[model samples]
Target: ETLVLTYDVIANDGDTDSNTQTVTITITGTNDGPVASGSYEHQIVDGPGADTYDDITGQLRASDPDHEVDELTWTLPDGQGQYGTLTVNPDGSYTYEVDEAAVNGLTDGDNPVDSFTVVVTDPSGASDTRTINISLSGTNDTAEVSGVDEGEVIEAGGGDPGVPTTEGTLLAVDADNPDNRFQPDSGRGSNGYGNFVVDEDGNWSYTLDNDNPEVDALNEGDTLTDTFVVRTEDGTEAQVTITIRGTNDPAVIDGDDSGTVVEAGANGPGEPVAEGTLSSGDVDNPDNVFQLEMGEGDSGYGNFVVDESGNWSYTLDNDNPEVAALNDGDTLTDTFVVRTEDGTETQVTITIRGANDPAVIGGDDTGLVVEDDAENTVGGTLTASDVDNPDNLFEPASGVSNGGYGSFVVDANGNWTYTLDNNNIAVDALYEGETLVDSFVISTADGTSRVVEITILGRDEPEVLHPVHIHRHDSGGDLWVPEVEGFDTGSSRPSGSFDRSLDFVANWLRESSEHEGVVARLWAALKPRDRLVYTSDPFTFNLQAGTFLHTDPGASLVLEATLKSGAPLPGWLYFDRETGEFSGIPPEGYEGEVHIRVVAKDSDGREAQVQFTIKVVDEQEVGMLLEETPQDDTSNEQTLRGKAGFSAQVAAEAGGNDLQAGARALVASLQALEN
Candidate 1:
């Protein structure tokens, strides 16, 4: 710096004359302080290894107008600035190097300024100071993330957990940022295998989508790795690797679960009813085997069997009611469960088909009835059973007669009835004690048939007689007896000489009775004197006249009998005179009528006599006689067939000599017949 001073000394000379002698004073120029001016600016990037701003050499200038540039000195008040260091020369040229550490320590922003003061001085000690500004422009520092990058997640066990995941913490730092917290929007990333997410605090998780086919196909003990990148807001990324471990999978089943077979060869101890094969699949265990909870299994209607190879069979139990009752075209079902060693199960079903079984007809096939019984019908119940069909029906021929002997009827319920035609010629032709079996075919709906027999026994219809009552007085007198007093009018009788004797006896009875009523009554009581008998059968009779004769109450009476012609009884005839019971068997050669007369007497000398006849005939003659007689006359009666050769001894003590002799003679006759 230079200075010039001018002083007017005329005042000091103090006089006009002194003004003529004016003083001239001159001062020499001296060096002055330099003026420091001008501003310095440079860009400083923040971070390690950043470049320094050295262009301030001419940017900060100071000059000395009164002093030489060499005499002027430029000095920095402090070499160290808040963000860098400064250096200067006498010419005011300076260099500034921004501290890398100081720039890094500066609060992060778009661009910041660091200013420091520098001074320039001359030899006179005058100085000037200027501010040096350094603009700090930050360089983006690489954001770093650090943490455990590996994670492990196990595959879902049987699909229980749908997603497998693992979590870890990631730490991030950015030297150029005031806030190091991650931004969720840019902090998460995913790859083909899984997704990864990170929070502001750098907590991260990797989740595997197990539903993916690639992941699901994994086998036990097999592993997979999923890589995902967790990034910071500045685009810095870190990898999180997730390892997926697999577990055992359940077994699967295939093939048909149902089958069918015939029951014929599949029942009892026979072969299996149905057969099937099963298949299982397990990627984790390729050699999986089937498991049976028990050695043998029951399928409700049958037995079930299965092997480790998944071969299964069902056997029907013959004793099971449902299986046994199966009919042709009928079906029965049996269900059972088959399992795998891994506890997988499938339901197996078996259907059994049926075959026809013959229907059985049971119960009484033989029936019995007597021809002479009030109802001469023979019948019995029938039973039928079928294993296949519960309801049984008789054939259409039921309720119809196949033979003339009887009509046989059957119902759907297996009940049957056989009615004998007693009046049929074939039935009537049956001899006494003979049996005729009426057989007919009975059948089931299936065309199975059996013969049913009805036994019809022939029985003789013995003659039933209505006796005639004759009242007698106590007085002793001659009494006349009707010839056939107690004979049944329903009986068949022979004609001829026997009729003549009956007429004679009727006249005698009419002479004694006298009254018209008595005559009519005697006529009704009179049986024909002739009787017909089969030569094959023996015959017997009683006089039946004592009922019509009258005698004294205290008198002893005896009966005397002979042929109507006063002939003795036939050789075949045996008589008990006291009681007048006659029994005889006619010889085959003798087939004719024999006349008989019976007389009764008492101690009072009263006597009565009646005559009757018996005729013997062969079977053919008897048939002819039956035909000649009216059906109504013979329908209700049959000829008496008696056991032959019965005799009785009598002691006679009658009042009259003739009666006593007759009694003795009758006794002798009976005794001789006995021999």
Candidate 2:
């Protein structure tokens, strides 16, 4: 079929279809797309302001409902001076940085604004753009003011609001503020606001007349409720609670009196008052028991009770008899027994008293008498009297004799006499000028007695008589002989004896030269025993001679006699061989007594004679005898007689010259008897 169909469509109005009778009809739909009314939303977030140290990175989000975006780019606004550089990221984010010079340029006065754009391209080549504004503000940072209030109000019954509004008793504040601004007369000042009064120290005060109306009028224990507050000058406030307590009133009792008393026994005159009457002014008070502080002797004796109307009587009963019998100077006391209404008793005591007696004597007086032969007389006598009984008499009752006298005899009148001896010798004679001590007891009818002593003066001269003797001869030699050989020698032979008188011869012979030879011999015999031995080696002698004789020859003989005893007697005798006589003087030193015995033998060997007691004189007399007599002459008989006479005279004058006559007689007798 290859049949082509051509048709000419007639125009709606008179179009000529004559030109074209062949009609060709072709309908083609091409892909030219309908564009949707695109809704694109783009948001631009400004980067942190482009100052130094600021966060400058910002993100931009653009959304298209109909197309996709192919790229995101950011552009800085054209008029932005070199404040910073802007960079766009693929994710629709941008970063802007201010250079050091730009940062320096943004000083206190040179603040600038920065604007930038972010462009987003869709897949269809459709583009969207958003703009962001970044502004730089000044860099001055400061702390904000805190705890401030503009104004405050307190309710009427709200108490102290405890807020730091105006300075008052309910509010205290700190003076220092953050701004350091203070105004004393202004509400914002530390001590300003309301009726507050400030002291010199800058502390604040106020009148809480409404909230704490009773604060000034309240007592210590009164109760109250209030709030307290503290505030700072900057208007900072702090609150505290305050409560008022109740006060106690002073106590009261009836009468207004403080003290009361009670009687010892009853409850009236000295009765104690009630306990509450003397109140310390306290409620529910305890009872005050009554007490008697001071008693008779101490403080506790008087009566005390609890009842004010009780009666009491005090009867002292100290139990001290001395106090009961007190005198004018006496002090007395008694204990008080207090009885209560309940019949209970307590005791208090008292005391003091005394007595005395007069003085009296306890001892007696005594006396003493002088001794019989004491040198002093008039010894003292003692008198005695009793202190208690002075009128009593003293009399002697016993006695002793003094000076060897008899007991004393007292006369009726109390005078005494002392008889010394029974033989009528006076007391004076016995005393011998000494004190005659007589002790005697003198007694009175009242039985009182005293001892007395007496002393007497004695006769001055002693009573002694010389012995009597009768003289019968003128020659004298009398002595006493001892029984022992070495004892005293017998007296010399006297011329005669006298009847009752002394011959006086012995005394005369002691002074006579005629006895010189005898005296010398006696002295030698009386020599001490140690001197008796004779020493013949040197022929030393101590001798005295009674006579010298002249013989018919021209030479003379010397007889030296000695008295001796004990042993080898004749052997001890030394005689000169040529002279037919003994020689050698006796030793010079002799003492005490010498004794000897002699025996003479006759030519026929019959014993002839014995003699005793020869006397010897001292050396002085012997020398006198030798010097006074002449050497013997043997030439003629007359010469011999003359020499013998001369020797007799020398013997008589040896002691002295008085015995010369006796010596002459002895010589004549020797001459006449020679036939």
Candidate 3:
């Protein structure tokens, strides 16, 4: 500090000399250092490669009372040695340009900001400082994807995030920011699943994108390994390799269900109608085998028979009568359930259509007839029907019989007739307790033929002549006639052989009157009986009692008679008690003369007793066959004796029983001629 003393010299010089006074100066101490009026701070971006502060160095109006501002120099205060190089101008200004390279080189935990002081100093070493903070903050690091801790497993289809699924999502994060985005790097191995989806808020997901060839190629149970990089503005990254595994998918099946087919193999519902294999596809395990279950959920719709290799066919239950009765245009459906190797079931439908079924014949396979003495033979007839065609007819083909088989006749109206043939070979081959069978063929207009078996039944009764000569003489001059109860009042013979007249005689005998002796004698004398005289040993006479010649054993032959009669002609005649019918085969070893006595009563109770004589000839000892009669062939029309003989048609009409009888009669006539 300085004080000035001044003296003024005037031109009226001598007189103004007193006016110019003398000034004395004194030095005083004043504490006036450099004062600053401005404050400033700067922050640099600290970009990756390079950065410019663009004159970030600010100005401070710093001045010193005793020193020129130009004399003042600027000094930078080091704050924790953070301030690097700085240039200050004479105007109390220091331009700051951040070293972007050095700032970027800082470590993660290193201080990213540098704060220092701007000091103004005079030549006297007077100085004042202001804090000018210079901060270096990085732009940002790469975004981080979080929440992908475990491997992801998808159904090979798709998945939703945070929905309790084995599939997961990824979250992107920047430690310095809340808003971030993540995406798979283009070079990453995302081909297996393609590129996953990412939202603006950092959400990751996987979806089925068939449009993408990679996603379309994904199969069930297939696994994929891929890597991706997540990034932010600073080009930092997080390399994450996620394992994505796939799961299975179901198969698809297609069928031809609308086709209609006729039946095969005898044209029945249970038989197969069509043949084919359904088309199927599966991405995973496509080569696996497929099988058709017994039914498609409903068994009643029928079923399918499939081969191990998946060949299939449709069939119906023709064994069911309802199905068998179907007509043309009738339909039967079957459902098929197909199962894959993995046991997945798929259902399909198949149908069958009927057309032109064969004609059906009604009646038993066998026709049974009883030769009731040949006068009233009992037989049956046959009928035919066609469920498919209404105007079908049955025709007669060649038939074989010896006269015991029933006659067969068909009219244009499809009506048929069958008359019993009593004179057949069965008559001779069958004995009193035996049976015989004859076979024949019958046909339909459609060229179909079926074999019909004929069984002739017979029984031995008391020999009944046109003029039966059985009579008994009573004391009152009344004649008692013996009646064969098994013989009907008409020309026919009845069925039952046992007589109820025996009880009448027993009752008569039990109730004795004063003329009881005479009544008793009359009862004893008057009983049903018959007489038979046959001249031969081992006579083969047709008769039937028990079962027909069939594989089944429970067959029966029942006999019922009205004409009261005593025991039927016994001799070779044997009655089956169970069947109440005379047997066909006679008793063994029955020799020459055997008597059969019978007591019979007519419907009027006129009873009498009669006897029969059977002169059995030992067949071995007798000359049963002619010496050279050319073996009596009935199939030929000509005769051995140069005379007209019965034709094969006649022989067949006669049946086996009658054929044998005719042969015997012819033999007898020849014998008579010889004798």
Candidate 4:
């Protein structure tokens, strides 16, 4: 090797003097490290539905300051990457290939970067190290799911279902995503027959909703095949199939068939009236047809018939006596059992409403009478005819004239007689040639009335009147009295005191007007108001009782009580005639209102009555004042005694001496009766 240097020199003393010199030298050249630089990038493509991919190729660009790029040899130390293999040639060319299993396992957004060391050297064996980076971009891969091939289920009404319907399991897989699972919220679907569901673990099941009416639409021995599509989270769809078989169903008859028709003769028995249609269905039969059971109908007052197509008609017997007896607004119901050919039965009710037909009466409307006649009577017969009301008769058999001239009587057969009273003032005042007319109203069973007038002709008689002498006498005498043995002086003090009290009461009641007023006031005050009593509680009611105002102190007066209907009181109730009180405990399970009527009467047959009601309830009508106790069949005597005692104590505190005396007397009388 040779070296040369060229220079120019100049002295500081002169500016015009300059020289150019050249020198030659020899040196040895040694190989230095080749500088290396390169960068590589590659993208892996995964087409839709494509699984396998080829290797990725890249160039390791390098530049050496001392040698040509071709002369710089490239070497890779550790050519293995995490996901692929990297190879570099001595010519600075390289390739990176991802493992087949790793490529197949790549999912969306999976990018892998690989790195290796590259050494560039000259022929002299001097080298420089550089890092080569290989980067790869990922592509999306397709996902897949498995399908449920076939399944079987029984239709509704096919007998008991011992086991659930089973279909094949569904499976899903994604090589790019090894942890693939089904999304249940978006993976469940339904069809007309059943619903399909898939769990997160890719397990699937199909449940038959047997309650659907479509399941019963299939006939016996019929099969229905249904198919449905299910999807995965990545929009992968699969088909599932189900086959449903059918069974027999029973015949059914509609139970609510009824009709209302106006009775015949309202318009003269024109035609038979139509009821409603009778409907029946049999799903197992062809065309769901049903036949009516023929010759099985009856009606008391009419003819009932049904046809094959479920139409019915009723024709009333207008001429029948019972049918004709029905009044206006009267109704009768006829029931008939209708059936299908399969013996399914339902009842059909037909109601007949009645209308009235006017009645006719034929007879004389006027009559004549003679005051001089021996009997002084006018008589006649009447005839009545009614289409709707047969065998009619007059309502009242006898009656009296409004005028004081006469009276009238009639029989059920319409035979009537009007007789004039000879002693009547109006009849006696009549003079010769004068006439009096009397009218009476008569009615038939149908409330049809007619007025009949009778004219009485006056006549003169020549019989003379006679008078007899009368005598009167007045006498006065003293009446004798006898004393009883027990009442002569006194037997026991209590008995004498009781007798004296009774005598005072009787005398005071008979002589004192104040006593009558007091009694009336007491009666009015004691009248019980309407009360609500709960069952299982004792009830005590004091009714208004009083004695009639009569001059005779010994007049027998009694009070009796009973139900408003004149029926005897119930066994649970007791009426004390002396106290005019009704006390009883209503038994369990008894609830209703009891209407009581109390009557006070005297020996003279005069009566005074008052009615009141006691409503019995199962629950407390008023607000509770104390804690409730369990109710049973036991009597509520404690509660009754407490109330009665409180009332008696209050009366005693109020200084009612008469009430106290009466209470004492009552107690004594009760004791005596018990003894």
Using lDDT as the measure, which candidate wins? 1
Candidate 3: stretches off by over 4 Å: 1-189, 196-207, 211-230, 236-247, 250-281, 286-288, 291-308, 311-317, 343-675
Off by over 4 Å in 2: 1-70, 74-225, 229-237, 242-257, 260-675
TM-score of each: 0.41, 0.20, 0.37, 0.35
Q: For model 4, how many clashes?
A: 0
Query: Per-model C-alpha lDDT, please?
Result: 0.58, 0.32, 0.43, 0.57
Backbone clash pairs for candidate 1 read 1-32, 1-66, 1-67, 2-66
RMSD of 3: 21.7
lDDT of 2 by residue, 1-675 (tens): 134456875444356444434467554433222122222222222222322355477666666554443333333344243556667676666676655334533333444566665566555455566665556543322212233222332322212233223332222222122332222431212322233433322244333333233432333344444443344343434443333342322223322232222212211122222122222222212223223232242333222233322222333332233322333244444344433222223332323221111112122222333334343222223333322223333344323342224455553334555443322233323333433333344554333444344434444444332221222223543321212111122233333332222121111111223431222111111111122233332233322222221111122323223343212223334544233233334444532233432222222222211112222334332222122122222431111211111222212211321221122112222211100
Instruction: Let me know the TM-score candidate 1 reaches against the reference structure.
Output: 0.41
> In candidate 2, where is summed lDDT lowest over 10 consecutive residues?
520-529
The candidate that achieves the highest TM-score relative to the unseen native structure = 1
**Candidates sorted by lDDT, best first:** 1, 4, 3, 2
Error of 3 at 506 (Å): 58
Off by over 4 Å in 4: 5-20, 25-28, 43-50, 103-112, 136-143, 147-154, 157-164, 176-188, 197-201, 218-279, 282-675
**How far out, in Å, is residue 580 in model 2?**
99
Q: Which scores better on TM-score, 3 or 4? A: 3
Residue by residue across 1-675, what tens digits does model 3's lDDT show? 565545454334565454444455565666578877675756655443333345365676787888777878887654233434465665766666555445544434444556667778888788898776676666543345566534453444422221112334556544444435543333323554434443444344444333344443456556666555545433445544555555444556565533344553233333445566655565554644676354421445345665544566665555444455555568766566667654445655666655445666665446665555544332334556765444446664333232224456544344444455444323422334444444445555543445455555656544321211112223322212123112122221122222221111001111222421223111111112222323342333322211122111122222222211122355445644343333333455554554433232323322322223434444544433112222224563213221122111212121222111112111112110000
- What TM-score should be assigned to candidate 4? 0.35
> On a 0 to 100 scale, what is the lDDT of residue 474 in model 3?
38
